[model samples]
Target: MFTPPPSPFPSKSSELSELEMTHDTPTHANPSAFPTHSCQSKQKYTLALRWTIILVPITLIAIGVSTRLFIHPTSFDALSPNSIHEWKTWSKSLTDWSLHERHKPTENSPWLAIVPGTNASPVIKRSTLSATPAPTVPINPTLPTPFPQPYDTTLSPNFSTTSCYNFFLNMTQTDALRSCRPFSLLLTRSQAFIQNQDDINATNIDIWGTCNTDLSSSQCDLNMAWFTSSLRSSCATDLSNQNAMAVSALIGLQAFDLMRQAACSVDPVANAYCYVEAVASSDASSYYFYQLPLGQALPQITSGACNSCTKSLMSMYSAALSSANATSLTGLQATYGDAATKLNNVCGSPYAQTSTVASSSAPPSVDLTSVGGTWAVLLAVGVLSTSMSS
Candidate 1:
């Protein structure tokens, strides 16, 4: 029985051939494990890539928003008086008149002379006398006398709408003095006030004291009080016409300086008021200056130098507020509130009234363009992320 089993069994070579065939045949072959693992890894990589595309832009946007909210300067920061020293230096340069070099009088200058009964002072002679004399006459024959005619008390006609920027270009001091002679009284008064504060009270001057025809007595009184508060000294009851004119000129100049400083400030509301005051001061200066005899071809004085600056600042303010993201809105509001409070404290009832009127009438405007730009950026990022993920 054992011999029969051996005969039936295959040889060793045949067994080897059978094993090789089993290894090569598709049915018995082992499945490739690497392919399944590679496929799984590829799927994971694709999912991670899609998520990264969606998250990167959002993260970057969040960082940018945070930066604007926390890092950008607020209105209060921009308008803070901490930088007043820089502003003072800038103002000195901005207001320096080239005419002073040639026209300003020295002790030995011929412009200094004695009137018959009055003490010696700097003076500029007038070419003509008005038909009607001013309320007060100059005791000194050398001083430029006020117009004798009953000129319009309102500052409308005298304000120069034309810009005087060209006058300073290639202008000689002599030419400046000749052209600016209309403002001789103003210049003289400013110089005198600087030298001796006792000579004038800025509030009692004719230019400021003359109540507007449109204003009621109470309104006029309120205006007078506001003007008085801005003066270097308390309002004076005993101002002569000459002294009043000097005081008026001094006040106008001071107001101009204040507006200039405010133009450099960051507060929107304060900037607006300062711009208005600047324009008013310029009008007053020009009105009084033009009253003098036309000495030479000086450039026509226009509104204050802060006009362009004010517009620029207001535009910036609107743009910043409008562009501010939701995250930054609270901070910006707080900044504006602080600035408003400070302005109310400094400017008192005048600021309160004007701000109230402004707020009630037109309210603050936002720059839609800036807001749209922010939205456009976010939209673009979203679109890009969608496209990449798809």
Candidate 2:
């Protein structure tokens, strides 16, 4: 060890004790007395925390603002409850119709059954519906007495030109008859009828729920009554004397009438008739032939096979043939005679059945496989359809 000259300093133990006290105990006024990396580290951490506090809310606000500006209302509305429910309803209706299952398979009410006790034809009451009687429609001076027959079913000529058909159109569309609903729907629906008479399966005038109680209360009752009455009149059915519009008019009017009669059920839904279906195909076909074209074409109409309520229906329609025989209107007779034979061969016959389709018992419930943890694909379908139809 090197020898040192000692004078001002105390012994090593006393000097070490004072030095330790100085380093261990810090003073506020002498804060910088000892240089410290620990203080620097704490300062850096505080700065980082302050910046995090300031930036976090700002980052969240920016994201929210960006989403509001960028996203569309319709894109967001796909998630709405109304859009989801409405889309499902229409989809279910279409599926049920196409599958030949007209009625929901609700357990059939026993009284509604047209079985052995009811046997269909005898128990039903006569239709309360009747058309207002009108005289023969005459040609106006604006046109020739015998106008040329136009072949197109779709012509809605100017009112002045349609002298013969104008009277009926007036009953439905004139401002005086606003209750008939504007646009003269009968005029348009008649055109539609001529196009798809075969595809039509129901005579439901109650589509809007406005006319369910009785046809007379319907907004278009006067028009409907007149349209039905005019076509069945002996004069309107005469092929020898009328124009082509008359031909088209009668075709559509009779279609509307037939459906009106079918839909004017004493019961709810078309299913009371649809319940004519059976577990076996052969027996099912046997029950309802009286209403089909072939059955109607027969010189003497007859149906006893199932003797179901459709038999009663065929009986009510049979009254039309009696009028037809008196009027000598064979065409109208055929149209009226087949009211029991359902559209799409749904009731109890194979006349309208085709190979491409197989019957289903009921429509399927709305369902979809979850994908990527999302709701049913119908949400996407509803979204797409909303984009187009809404």
Candidate 3:
């Protein structure tokens, strides 16, 4: 009787076959319910393939760019030839004019205070009202004594004697002496300018009336006093004391080199001759006033002496000259050459001659590190976006 009821249904074998078919075929009408293993694997592979297609090249490019940028960098000396030429031309013109004017003054002129072969120091009388009695202060016997007058006007009144003394106390003798060089130079140069009142007036043409002339002069004197006292007391290493005049000469040369740079920066075209004239005047004042006087104070400041100092000074000048871009190397060459010659005559030459001009034809260095890095990042982002979308 049960078999009879099952007669309406399929046979056992057919029923089994039907069940097998049903298991094999899709269950849902959409055909999505029974996904094949092969199909799923293929879909995953396609997604991976798409991402690989997008990201592989991006990764490669990023790596390539990063490598390039890390190698090369730009520097100030890498200016274009044309720019260098313009700078040299302008600087040379101004320098020429200045040199010509400088020579025009007669030996008897009051402005020409420092005679070439004589004592270079200017005869200055200390104001009785402001002069303090030399203090019987205890000083390091290892250091120089009877410190020179203030030269640098940039320092606090107590800087040389108090601040410098305190600061230099912790340093080695060599370091302390080296530190004093800049201050000594500034002081000597400033004093030289002050002594040459005519040179100061001429050089300060632009700033004289408008730039608070009276205050500047007073301040300058005050600063010089500070430097003079500091070098005498605080920076008074034995070596410095022995070679005080030599140190003064070396620093003076450095000041002259600095003045050349300042002069070069004066736009001859835009400012006409005024700016250049001012620069020249200022430079002359500094040289003849402070530097000459300081050098004259010691025996070592003369020519054929201070050989080490001359080398150091030449090195600094060479570095500065090498940094400028100009068509003609003549001006720079002449400037440093003249300086070297003067030093040789005054002190002596142990220093090698330096090339004053930069090569115009030198290939400009390209800094691609920045550009390459940027491209690498952009490509990486594209790869990431593709991966996410996939």
lDDT tens digits, residues 172-284, model 1? 12222222222223323333222221122221122221212234434433443343343323223212223433244333332322222232232244332232233234122
Q: In model 1, what lDDT does residue 51 have?
A: 74
What lDDT tens digits, residue by residue, belong to model 3 across residues 168-279? 3332133223323233242333453333333323323322221222234334434434544554555455225444333443334334334322322322234322222322
Candidate 3 residue 22 Cα shift, in angstroms, is: 99
Best by TM-score: 2
Candidates in order, TM-scores: namely 0.16, 0.28, 0.20
Q: What lDDT score is found at residue 80 in candidate 2?
A: 31
lDDT score for candidate 1 against the true structure: 0.31
Location of the lowest summed lDDT over 10 successive residues in candidate 3: 72-81
Off by more than 4 A, model 3: 1-112, 115-301, 304-307, 325-333, 342-349, 357-390
Instruction: Show the lowest summed lDDT stretch of 10 residues, model 2.
Output: 117-126
Candidate 1's TM-score: 0.16
Q: What ranking emerges by lDDT with the best candidate at the front? A: 3, 2, 1
Which is the better candidate, 2 or 3, if ranked by TM-score?
2
Off by over 4 Å in 2: 1-162, 165-172, 175-242, 251-259, 266-309, 322-330, 334-390
The best candidate in terms of lDDT: 3
